[model samples]
Target: MAQSSSKRIFLCNSCGNEYFKWHGQCPACSEWDTLSEFHPPKSRRKSNGAPARKTTKLHTITHKKDRKRTSSGINEVDRVLGGGLLPGSMILLGGQPGIGKSTIAIQIVAGCGKSALYVSAEESEDQLALRAERLGINTKNLHVSGENEIMNVLEQVSVVQPSLLVIDSIQTVYNEDLDSLPGSVSQIRDCGQQLLNACKQKGFTVIVIGHVTKIGTIAGPKMLEHMVDTVLYLEGDERYDHRILRSVKNRFGATNEVGVFHMTSAGLEEVTNPSELFLAERTANTAGTAILPTMEGTRPILVEVQALVSKANFGTPQRNTNGVDSRRLSMLLAVLEKRLGNFMGMNDVFVNLVGGLKIQDPAADLSIISAVASSSKDNVIADGTVLVGEVGLTGEVRSVARIDQRLQEAAALGFKIAIIPKGNMKNVKSFKGLKIHGVKSVREAFQIIF
Candidate 1:
C-alpha cells in the first residue's frame, strides 16, 4: 500500500478550529485574520502484523512510595511548584515579553545542580550564555542549544540524556513535517506534544516557556494546556518590579500556589517575605489606608488597601478601583451605605491595592470597606492594626478561611491588633503578640475602626 499525499487545511490560531479553506474571520472565536494554512498529520497505514498484547496486574506493578523531586535553586518557584518538581513532568510556563520567564527557567536549570539542556528557539546560545553570566549562573553541567526543529532537538536530547530540559518560548519552535509557520496553532500544538512525549519517555523534567497574547493569556490552542502535566504563569505588569509565579494547574500538587519575586539588575530575586515588601512604604495614620492580611494559597500576605472618597467634581460620581474588581467595590460600597448609612452615591470613590498586586480573595472585603469608610468619615484607623473578613450582601461580616494563618502573618509583621469576623474567633485559642477584635456585622466593624 502506498502512503497518501498530505492535504492542506486551514486552522484558526485563536480557537484551534480547522477549516477546508482560509476565511476572513474565524467563525469559532470571531477573530479576524487569525486563520492560517497547515497540513494535518497523515493517517497511519494499516498493519498486517498482529499488535502486541500488553497487560499489567495492579498487584504486580511496583509502586514508588515517594515521588522524586529536585530543587530548582529558587525557593519561591519551588514553593509555587508544590515544594519541588518531579522527574518526567512537562511544565508549560507562560508570561508576557520581558517578564522574566526565560530568566526563571535558566535559574531553575542552574540551581538544580544537575545535567541540563537549554533549547532556545528565539535566541542564540551566545545570548543565553550572556544572560546566564549576568545572572551569575556558572554551571558546567548546563548545556545550551539554539535549535528550533523538534526532531533535531530530540536527537540532541537523546544524545545528552540530561536530567532537565528547558525549551525557551515554545511558539518559536516547530516541526518540519507540519506545513505551518512557527508560532501558528499547528506548530505550537505539535511541538509541545512531541516534546512532552520525549520528556516523559526519557524520565526528565521539561520546562517549556510560552508566549502570551496581548490579552494576557497563553497564546496557542487551549488543548496545549491540557497536554502538559503543569501550567505555570508568571504574572505582573512590566511597569512594576515585582513578579508573581502562580501555579494555575499542577498534577502532582495543589494549584493556586504563588511565588513572589522582585526584578533586579542581577535578575529575578526571590522575595521571602512579600508582606514586608508590600507594606514597606505604607504611611502611618493615613485616613484612606488600612492594612489587610490576605492568603495566597498557603502563604499569608499583608497588603495595604487604600480608598479615596471625595465630592464628585462632575455628575455621575465615578467608582474606580485598581487591583480589586470594580463590581466587588460597588457591592461593598452599597453595603456600607445601606448598613452604616454612609451616603457614597454622591461622592467619587477610588480603591487601590498598594504595590500593584491584584486580590481575588473575598477576605479583603472588610479592609476595602474600612478604608473607604475611613476616607469618607475623615478618620484614620489606628496604626499597627490589620483587617481580614468577607462582607456579605446582607451587612454581615462572614468568616474567611485560614484565620490563624492570617493572624500569624500579622503578628509576625508586628501588627498589634486585628479586626476579623466574629465567626473566626472560635477557631483561635491563643496567638501571641496580636489582639483580635471580632465583629458580627459591618456596622460593628466600622464602629471599632472609628
Candidate 2:
C-alpha cells in the first residue's frame, strides 16, 4: 500500500491554534516558544483475529456502576480532592520545586492501603525509598519504578494492574515516537494524552505530578490542564512552613477549595483550625495589622493583613506586597489617596498576608485599606475587630459572598466586633455575641475602625 501524504503544520500548545509555519511566539495567546511542529494522527490497521461487535443501546445496557470513592485517610487532601479519589479519574498536581509534591503523593498512596504503582522520571528508586522511610510510610503494596520512557511505564502498568497510578513530574516523561525532546510542548501533550487514554481503559485512578514554570503556572501546554479531570495547585512560600493545596479546576466537585498543611520534619500535617493557627501569634493592638474573615470555598478563615508605610528617601516610592497582588495594592492606594485624602502616594508601602497564604478574596479589601490607614496614622485598631467587605473604585464598600458564614466564624474565633458592607448588614438579622458595624464607604470604615 502507498503511504498517505500528510502536510506539516505548526500548532500553539497553549490555545490549540494551528499555524502554517513556526513562529517565535504564539499570536493567539502571546506566549513565547509555545508553538511546536505537529504530527497528524497515524491510522491504525485492522487485525485479522475477530470482527467488530454491534453497538448496544444506552437504555438496554445493564451495568453495576460503583460510584464510591477511595479515601486517602488524609483529611486535608480529601478536602481538596472533593471527598475522595474517584476511579479512572486523572488528576494533575502542579507545584514548584521542594514544595512537597512527591511527599504528598507518597503519603496518599500509603494511606490508601491498596496496591499503588509510582513511576518517577525525576528521582531514583533509592531516593524515593529513603524519603518514604523518612515520612514513616511502610506500605508493602506500593510499587516503585524509575522510567522516563512512556511506553515502558505503560508496559509496567499492564503487568502490575494497580488500583492507583502516580507519575512524578510529567514533564520528564517522553514518548519515543515523538521527535521532540522531553518537556517540549509536543512531547508533553502527546505523553499526557497517552497516559489519560490508558487510565480510562483500565479502571484505576491516576495522579500526575507536574512541574511549574517561572511564572508559577504548570510547565506544559494549556491543554494539559484541560485534558485532566482535576487540576490542583500546591502553593506556599518556601521560607514558610505552611502549605496550601488549592483546586483550580474540578469536574466532579467544587473548585476554589483549599487545604492547609504545615510542613514538619516528619511530613506534611493537616491544620484543622487554620484561623487559630494564622492568628495565634498576632499582637493584641498593632497599628498596621487588621484581621479579616475570608471564605475559602465552604470554610471560613480569619487571616491577619499587615501593612507598613514608611518615608521613601528616593524619588520613586516602592510598592511591595507578599501573598497578595501588587496591582491590587496599587489600586487600593489610589482609592485611599483619592477618596480619603490619605498620604499614601509619597510613602513606600508594603502589605503582607500573614502565614504565607495567598488570598484572592475581595472581601479583604476593607481590611487592607484599614491596615494601610492604621499604619499611616500610627493608631492601633481596637482588639477583637474583624473587617469583611470589598472596596469599589468609587470609594463605596461592596457586599461580599457568604456574609453569614464569615460573621459566624469571626464570632466563634472570639471576635467582638465585625465591620461589613451596609448591603450585607441589612440581610443579616443578628450575629451571636458579636457587634456588626455597617459602613458604606472607605471613609466610613476608617472612622468606625481607625
lDDT of 1 by residue, 1-450 (tens): 122225777777667777786899998889999887777766532222224546768765458655569998888988988878799899999988888899989889989999999999888878988898999987799989989888888889878989999998898898777767998888898888788877666689999999898998899887788889899999987668999998889997778889999999888998999999899899899899999899887899999999999999999999999999999999999998887789998899999998888879999999999999999999999999998899999999998999989999898888898999999998775678888899999889878879
User: Which regions of candidate 2 fall more than 4 Å away from where they truly are?
Assistant: 1-8, 25-27, 30-32, 38-65
lDDT scores for all predictions? 0.87, 0.87
TM-score of each: 0.91, 0.92
Question: What TM-score does prediction 1 earn?
Answer: 0.91
C-alpha positional error of residue 90 in candidate 2 after TM-score superposition, expressed in Å? 0.5
lDDT of 2: 0.87
Looking at model 1, report the run of 10 residues with the lowest lDDT sum: 44-53
